[model samples]
Target: MPGERIEGYATDPSALIERLFQQVAERSMVGLPFYRPQLPIKACAFQLLEGQLFGALLTPWMLQLMLLPGPGQRWDYRRADERLALAFPQGEILFRPGEIAPDLYYLSCSLLSPVDPALSAERAVALAENSVRLALSLPVRQTSVINTGRRALLRGALSANKG
Candidate 1:
């Protein structure tokens, strides 16, 4: 089976990285302290790693924004937090604190995508939650499939004696 490749396996390393990034976000957001409202978070920022790489080699900066309904008023994009202003261009409109349309309460997530051809759809949200969490120094739980050294050594010794 040398050189045999499995279908659906990402030949492109970028895709693997992207998938890992998404895993980080998915794991981080579940039962997350800031995730209670389930604000729409999106991947909107991208840093190019290489040019003309198959499927585009890019790293995305994932972000989420919360749009709290304005205090008895319509949404106002112009008044959104200045720090979040650059994340989403439409967010300037979608996340405005006022009413969505005078009666609806809604929020929007703006994202920087690594490979999303269509930018606005929720399906395009890239998973970079881990990068964000790491950058912010947020605590993360780690999991592994490999056995511990003690167990591995014991297993190796047992197999050697058996032979």
Candidate 2:
């Protein structure tokens, strides 16, 4: 919930949609498809976290995540002493490994269906980018990121105490 913000507006959904389309055309290289109610969203809007892209679209329902284009390559975020870092997907991002000191990537939702993390890594950026573009087209009221690192740290401490 770091960069989340809400504002009031009077424009209709369609009008916002048109503006978002125009914005996407101006902001990204991906040629997004026309928006449909049943289609999955695209685009991966990222922000700098400790001098890197720290945020992402982890899932489909998290419509609150910002829309942006992917850099079209993988970014490794581990320190010299660590290989994997705590990470999980919420909305559309994989929380960076350094976010938590212990785990390289924290697991969240089990594979509902077989998910190729590698493939997803590539496709999601596109989907997230599109999704953000679409969401920006609507009358948004709220937004939040899923911080799996924070949650896992609390859980680990509680479990350690119970032991």
Candidate 3:
């Protein structure tokens, strides 16, 4: 069957991104150099697809990440629209806002363009592995203290009410 959603769990968006990047980087399919950015990712959503891994990260602003099975290349941007004609000869990049949250958006990529549904299981696994490595290598963003505080307060209140 095609379009099978692989089962995976992440503690949070950040954790998920880290796991995915790690998987991609280890494959060494693409040369990924370490980079540290000032802005931290607020959240992320990632998934393993047959020939690609699709996910979005919220850095208080939205950014997308995609991985495919071809020559690995890296692309980064602060404003989504900055690179209108940018194309990933090895892999392409695209972004969209989260359905409910405008500040949040999604990033998607296809390892093999014109994705072949009939792609071999082994190939699919390889692609998925690379995607995960890419996710892990991605820069880790520090969560805002205000947001952390809010979460803690909410958790405490919920527990108190339950008791």
TM-scores for every candidate against the unseen true structure: 0.21, 0.20, 0.24
Best TM-score among the predictions, by candidate number: 3
The candidate with the higher TM-score, 1 or 2, is 1
- Tens digits of lDDT, candidate 3, 46-75: 444443344433221123454322113222
Alpha-carbon runs more than 4 Å astray in model 1: 1-78, 81-98, 105-107, 112-115, 118-163
Instruction: Report the alpha-carbon TM-score of model 1 versus the true structure.
Output: 0.21
Report lDDT per candidate: 0.35, 0.34, 0.38
Which has the better lDDT: candidate 1, or candidate 3? 3
lDDT of 1 by residue, 46-142 (tens): 2221221111112233343323322233333433343333232112323332222322222334433223433333333333433323223434568
Candidate 1, residue 98: lDDT:
20
Q: Which tens-of-lDDT digit does each residue in 82-110 have in candidate 2?
A: 33323222233332222222212211211
Error of 2 at 54 (Å): 8.9
User: What lDDT score goes with residue 3 in model 2?
Assistant: 38
Clashing residue pairs, backbone N/CA/C < 3 A, model 1 = 42-111, 43-111, 43-112, 44-111, 44-112, 45-112, 74-98, 74-99, 75-98, 75-99
**What C-alpha root-mean-square deviation, in Å, does candidate 1 show against the real structure?**
21.2
